[model samples]
Each structure stands twice: as structure tokens, then as C-alpha cells.
Target: MIKIDELREGFGSFWGSVSEGWDRLRHTAAGALTRFKPGEQTALPDRGQIDDPLHFPAQSWSMLGGDVFEDEQRLVVRIEAPGMEKDNFAIEISGDTLVVRGEKRFEGETTEGRWRVLQCAYGAFQRTVPLPAAVRGDEAKASYRNGVLKIDLPKVQPGKPTSVNIKVD
Candidate 1:
């Protein structure tokens, strides 16, 4: 009788843990799916829209995913920008920061057929990437091919030190 009671209690505890884990897993999956829903429309910001200086807009609103790599000579930045033309992007360098701004327009036929799903995000996006070291902004080269934008920023050479003699304090 004691052995049977212990076995039954252990089984009950195991079943309870399994049930709790299943519930938690289900809720986590549901929460992830609810974050981005189909047929959701996100309007693009206007040209003159001013964002808060402290906090920038969310990356979901306008995102241009990319990768940055550096070699002994130059720093290369490659951004994946599909469904866009070369004229849509504007790349600039201010101080030690590199800025890439572009607008991705959504083109779809919504009048003829019933829309079931829409998941692609489109709008104006600005990405500011700071260079690891000083670069020659004027000599920066950019090229776009097959939906990828690549920018090559050459690293600036360290300036030669100059010694000055002070006669009087």
C-alpha cells in the first residue's frame, strides 16, 4: 500500500509538470504569432515628420537589413534592399557616421481581388552606422547590384605628428 501510494503521487506530479509545460509552450507560440498579423497596414511617415530626438522609430517600421565587414584597407557595408531601384537610396557620410536612407514603395493590386495576406513592410528607412575608425568620406565608393547596395569606405591614414617649440609661458 505504501509503495502504490508513492507511485501514484509521483505520477500525479509528473503529469502536472507536463501539463504546465505544454500550456506555457502553447502560449509562447501564440504570442509570437500575434506580434505580426496578416493584412495589417502600416502607413509610411511623411517627408517632414520629426521623430523624438531621444528615441528613434522602431526597426519594424522601416528596416534595411545589412552586414558590415572590415579589412586591413577599407570598411565595407552591404545592405539588402530588395524590390527597390538604385535611385531610391541616398547614402551619406557625416563625421564618422555613415547614413543610408531609402524609401520602399509597395505596389499591389487591391481593387480586383480580395486580399488575404500582406506581410511585407514598406516605407522610408534611415540607418546610421558609425565607422570603427576614421574614414575618407570623399573617397567612399558605392555600388548597387542585384538588390544589394555595397559601400566601400577607405580607412584614413594617421596624420604625421608635428612638434612645436614654446618660447615663453
Candidate 2:
């Protein structure tokens, strides 16, 4: 027979593990999670207006998962941003941060009935990631495929220090 105290302890351990996982995720992906609201003119996105406004809320939130890697020659950033065209994305470097901005338009059924569940977020979103080293932003190249945006930026090489010798008086 299992004692009630033991059962309580087991449940507490499981919940503690779950709580720790959530805290770790929150810390690692602090700015990756974003909230997007409906545009001024449209309720949802560029297309796919919800037939019943009540079915969907005015705002929704989604997470953009990404990774930043650095090598001896260059730095690479890959972001998971589905449901968008290649033209929709705009990449820029502000200081030591890499900024990715885009809009994920909703293309739902035009003749649809009430949506059962609308969890996907729409509208414009921006995600910024800090870089480990200074990069040559002007020479950066980017591509989008398979719902992923990859950016390759060459690292800026440091100039050699110039030394001068003063004549002794």
C-alpha cells in the first residue's frame, strides 16, 4: 500500500521539474516569443478575414524559434518563420543585434464556417538577436526556404595596430 505522504511527495517532484523547464525556456527565449495584434484596416492579416469575429480574438501570440552560430570566418542566423513569403522579410543589423521583421499573413478558407480553433498569430512581427561579434552587414547574404530564413554575415577582421617610436630627448 502507498502512503498518502509518499504520493504527495511524488506529485511535488513532478511539478517541480515541470516548473524548472518552463523557467529555463522563458530565460533562453525571452524575446523570441511575440504578440501580434490585428492591423488597423484588417481584423486578421492580409487575407482570410474571419467570418465570425467572435471566433478569433483581436490579438494573438506566437513563438519564433531561432539559432545563432559563429565560426572563424562568419556568423549565421537561422530563424523558423513559416507562413510568409520571401519578400515579406526584412533583415537589418542595429549595433551588435540582428533584427528580423516580417508579416505572416493568414490565408484561410474564404467560404469557411466559424473557425474551430485559431491559434496562429498574424500581422507584423519583429525578432532581434544579439551577435557575439561585429559582422560585415553590408556584405551579408540571406535566403529563405523550407520555412526557414538563413543569414550569413562575414565577421569584420581587426586591423593591425600601428606602433610608433619617439626619439629620446
Worst 10 residues of 2 by lDDT: 41-50
Question: Over all chains combined, what TM-score does candidate 1 have?
Answer: 0.56
Which residue pairs show collisions in model 1?
none
Tens digits of per-residue lDDT for model 1, 65-147? 66778777788898777777898789999888888877666565545443344345565666777677678888999999998
Q: lDDT of each prediction vs. the true structure?
A: 0.66, 0.80
Candidate 1 stretches greater than 4 Å from native: 1-63, 158-169
| Candidate 1 root-mean-square deviation in Å | 14.1
RMSD of candidates 1 onward, in order: 14.1, 8.3
Q: What would the per-residue lDDT of candidate 2 be over residues 105-153, giving only the tens digit for each residue?
A: 7766767465645677887788898988898999999999999999998
